[model samples]
Target: MNIQQILKISADKLRQKNIPSTALDAEVLLLEALSKCADEIPPAPFLKGGVLANDAPRNDNKRLDKNWLYINNNYELNKKEEELFNNFINQRLKHKPVAYILNRKEFYGYDFYVDENVLIPRPETELIVEEVLKILNNDRREQACLFPTIIDIGTGSGCIIISILNELAKNKKDKIIHNAYANDISSEAISTAKINAKKYNLNKKIKFIRNDFEKFLNKKSIYNSNEIIITANLPYVKNDAYKTLSEDIRKYEPKIALTAGRDGLVCIESLVKSVLKIKKKYKQKIYIFIEADPDQMSRIMAISREKLANVNLEIIKDLSGKKRIIKLLYCHPELVEGWKAR
Candidate 1:
């Protein structure tokens, strides 16, 4: 059959299966199938706005309008390629996420290896990386010039830490010598993270430590440096809410990476307490950046107050105008007083 016919039929099948982005999904699957079969796609027609009849209605019959039929009739797929494309379409119908099907996701302009073993990186988490980079570039700490240890807690897929390191490597002005660390509780996650790190040639630069938060806490001697910058996008989805997530996420992504405790504040709270303990033991200032649901702000703030009285805190909101990242500047109480008095 022609390209149009296959896409229409596959999209119709997906529509029937209640796929949200039927047309887009059909296009991606078909293109992926074509690339997989080593087909040299023509650039003349398909490149010049010949893929989809963007103006066509969503209904089945309307999907095969004149604009689409012309392109479809011109482009045809062979038997084996057609079968492969159909298989991909079927998988989409099964509620599998596109990223998992592709086995790669673009995060911070870099591709990261992902699968069922680790949580798929989301757009929202990009804000965490951006904020951390900003802090590193402009941090006014007395030890700022010294190379800081950049630690990513629960480093799923190693996207955040690797992306940060990649950006730092590109920054000529700073010329910083930061040590990178990827800490995760899951062996599977650490394995996947290391793969991505090596893909970007950052494996040697980053130290991958497979341990839960508690174990990492006990082995604090590794972080002997005075300037420490810690960032974590740990499991913050509530257990009950996790059950209600989209089918693709609930079925495919790692549950351990998506969920925490009842209120979704378990990991974040534990992280806050751990950072406090680390600060007390090392007697050094620590900069902590955490990503959490907006709803958990008050509870997180309450913990900060109860545990770290007189701490300097900043809440950063994402593009959606919801609070997403929490930044804490841990200074001595006397330092805090001096800054406030100034």
Candidate 2:
């Protein structure tokens, strides 16, 4: 009958469903239904002080109904809103991520289309992107003319590489000569990545290749060193790792996109070794940015060091200050001409 009454009903339903962040979920679902961003929704106001649908001012009435939590808060949901809200809750109960249900995911400050084919992009991956951008932005030698080639390994949905281009193209539209590459072991994942790329009209901005990391490495016999920047969000979740994961993840997402291997370093091991050999051929340096499980980093670094001698290694931490990205640089002492550290 009122906003307070509707929230009570929805919140109770969510809690009973064992949904974490029940209140927040209810609020978001309702706000999205009305096509209103979270900021536009009214905060919980005075205890039961809000007006009813009919009695409330007309402008407030429409906005209020969109606030499904306020159902009867100040407006009533028309049929369309009612259908959407119900479908939203049904999907959530089945453990579908909100982004998946809405067919959208926010990444690097932009909303990207999503579907079952791609893993929902996480905020953590953005840390790797940030580190890569930091190195590019800090270069004093002119970021404009230098076309920095970038490759995203195991590029699920192409989120990492695409986000980098999106951010760069947003600002320095001219420093855009570099080729962008995205590779995924799974054909389906590659399809998903291409869809997102096409949606952004970045088909020309990035090249999508359906190949495994090992295959790509084997194929990189003639790559130039100065022309490359490698970034990856490898599946660090150990093969033995999935048993411990929540049912929500273990059941829904594609296995190839999640589990790396027996030690979770199987693919990573191959990548490090491949880069080491490639550096010799290229003669410049490789900017390596990657995400690894907390415990796996030490082993990854050790393996990388063995393969890449004299490579400057820096560990990147996420916003929460957890080490998430490993940035490795080659040719340290011989910093190219006017260039320092990149």
Candidate 3:
């Protein structure tokens, strides 16, 4: 059958199975399957329409561009292409995420490898990276410090920390003498993050630690007046709420990275408590950015009010206009007067 016919059949099958975004998922999976087959069979028939397996094209420019797969969807699929496409369709019927089937996901203009071990990077997470850039740029203009430290808590897939490093390296105004840390309790998550760091040639720039928040804080590290930024996208989905999530998420994605406690705020609360201890011991102000469920904002703030005595808190809304991120400026109580919550 032709390419268009195959896509239609696969999409219909997915729709019958109640898969969300069936059309888009069908297209992505088809392209991925075609790309994978192109490697084993050189100058493959389906590849003539410009779908090379490798990331970059050959130096001689003989290899067809990868984008051709999406551009020329009307091209015919050979017998081998039909076999591979069917297998992918079967996987999707089982509620597997397309990113996992493809082993790749794009975030903040950078692509990273993903699997069942880590949570697939979402678009909303980009906001955390954007806010970090704005804060760092502002600090460069106002402060005389030459080095800044970045710590990413529960850094699954290492998307947040690595994206930040790539952006910071581009700024010519500032010398990039930054110490970055990414810590995760799951060793599988840490391993996946290390793979992504190596993919971007950022292995040395980031220190990937396989430990939780409390353990990381217990280490013998100095926290002086130099700028420190903490970014956490820890688990915030409640246990009961996790059960209500779609099969595509609950079945395929790691549960350790999704559900918190009964209230969905246990991991976040623990991280905040650790930050309070760090602040008291070091006596240096630190800026924190976190991603949480929009509905949990009031309870999170209440936790901060009781545990974090001196903090300036602001809640940021996601693109959907829902409360998504919590920005906290942890410093002395007296300094809180000058800054207004945004």
Top TM-score prediction, candidate number: 3
Tell me how far the alpha carbon of residue 181 in candidate 1 is from the true structure, in angstroms, after superposition. Answer: 0.7
lDDT tens digits by residue: candidate 3, 74-156: 55676787789898899989999988987889999999999999999999999999998887766544454536678898899
Better of 1 and 3 by TM-score: 3
Model 3 alpha-carbon miss at residue 220, Å: 3.0
Tens digit of lDDT per residue, candidate 1, span 68-112? Answer: 434545566777778888888878999998888888889999999
**Candidate 1, which segments miss by more than 4 Å at Cα?**
39-73, 139-144, 173-175, 333-342
Q: Write candidate 2's Cα lDDT for 1-342 as tens digits.
A: 333555567778878877778777776677666554323334433424454433432345344434334434544455666567777877877777777777788888877777777788889988887877776665553633455678888898788888888877777742643567898888888888887888777888787878877678666532543556888887778877789986557656767777877888877788888887776756555678878876777887888888888887888777888878888877634546436444
CA lDDT of each prediction against the hidden true structure = 0.79, 0.72, 0.81
Q: Which ten residues in a row have the lowest lDDT in candidate 2?
A: 38-47
lDDT of 2: 0.72
Which pairs in model 2 have colliding backbones?
3-73, 70-73, 225-282
In TM-score terms, candidate 1 sits at 0.86
RMSD of each: 6.1, 5.0, 4.6
Q: Which candidate's lDDT is highest? A: 3
Ranking by lDDT: 3, 1, 2
